[model samples]
Target: MFGWLRRKFGKTDRFARLDATQFPRFAPGTVWLVGAGPGAPGLISLLGYYGLGEADTIVYDALVGPDLLAMANPRAEMIYAGKRGGKPSPKQADITLTLIEHARAGKKVLRLKGGDPMMFGRGGEEALALARESIGFRIVPGITAGVGGLAYAGIPVTHRDTNHAVIFLTGHDEKGGVPQAVDWPAVSTAAPVIVMYMAIKHLGSIAEKLVAAGRSPEDRLAVVSNATLPSQSVVETTLADASTLAARTDIPTPAIVVVGPVSRYRQTLDWYTGGENALG
Candidate 1:
């Protein structure tokens, strides 16, 4: 099942050298929620790798890449509970129920999610449901796309020269519309940089709100798609034109949108597949 390890490490027991005690066993009857990291399999944490190798069942989200899934024990039960906006997806409650059912049956259950499990991925909700059922669980954090994806796009979330403070926000609410709770006036001037997750769908409305709340319409914004993967693409625009630019059907999803001067850093720090983080 861990054939990748043999292919990569060539039979070296690296774990033994690094202290085997640090790599904890994936005990049966406990559920582990692990972030698979933005779209790349290699970004998965060590604990995540261990959990995959030992898990009896893996309940994975839509954004979790197939490469990461290929690392799991071949005999493990794989459940797809991916939630794509506006698509037919499994209900959250039912997915949690699956974890509880698997754990109660004395199986090593793993919840594989994209980005940080707790960052807009609904990992907290699932964990709460598991706790209510008295099912033991662990959280293995990974690089969130809001942070890692921007880095791949060569845009810093925060820079000493530009923004000293930053805000992370989800673009939509339970109804899948622009978040009504965001205090537009307060947040518009609150942080130097604002990173929005899943906001592309409602960018036109959101941009209007921010501009009305004192944010400059000409503020820089970049949309990073399929982050950290070879297929990744960056679209740069001003907040004034963000809606019109994102309106193109070609722009990919599972994207992170950044608003601020941080995106301008791509001119220098960009190391990923890039020509220019500028609008064509």
Candidate 2:
């Protein structure tokens, strides 16, 4: 409703009203593991925005978009430690060491990641390493795509009529293959809604396993690609067609997969169309 106020005042004028003293100072010689949120630059938390303005170094990932990085302090060093399909991602140990090196040098370090830093982003591992080295750090949470992205697609992750519970899992393990540890049988029945991150590569196998383990082949599934971005798109399919869909479609990376009746909401609840708010 205040879109006009935002348009009139703009974010710059609005930002002037923030009470900086209320926030913990981003001191030099410390690191902050900040989640960049799903995809939208504006989704970054206020604390995250504070860190971006104060940090001396931004250790960002592939999912950290250029627009988001533009918010950082002009003098902040930008370090790319992202995993590309064909190129080698810097070693975890190396990334940890880098954070430590910069922190020890008395720099305010921002280990910026896509989505919640703690959720599958390996922020815990880096935190552990930092702890061992006595490096002070903080965790700044952001919205994960599984929830925010699904909402953008008009799919509520939960609904009283459909599911009392939901499940979240990765499609691949440390070795970048289908996780061998998931007990498909148990997973198939554990929740009415299943959300998979980084699962597109092995989605065919995952869909097959779920179907074989008692989940219906006809269950609704939504493949949300580049979720929350202007280019975001959702492919409504079923477990039976998941494999074929995975093989035939060139869905973008950084996608989230949803299974169960929650996807049925997309037909009516979809409020984002061609990057515009459908409710408008």
Clashing pairs in 2: none
lDDT of each: 0.89, 0.88
Instruction: Compute the lDDT for candidate 2.
Output: 0.88
Worst 10 residues of 1 by lDDT: 12-21
Clashes of 2: 0
Q: List the lowest-lDDT window of 10 residues for candidate 2.
A: 1-10
What candidate 1 gets wrong by more than 4 Å, as runs, is 1-4, 7-21, 275-280
How good is model 2 by TM-score?
Answer: 0.93
lDDT of 1 by residue, 102-213 (tens): 9999999999999999999888998899888888899999899999999888888989999899999999998898898989899899998999999989988899899999
RMSD of each: 3.0, 3.9
Q: If scored against the real structure, what TM-score would every candidate get? A: 0.93, 0.93
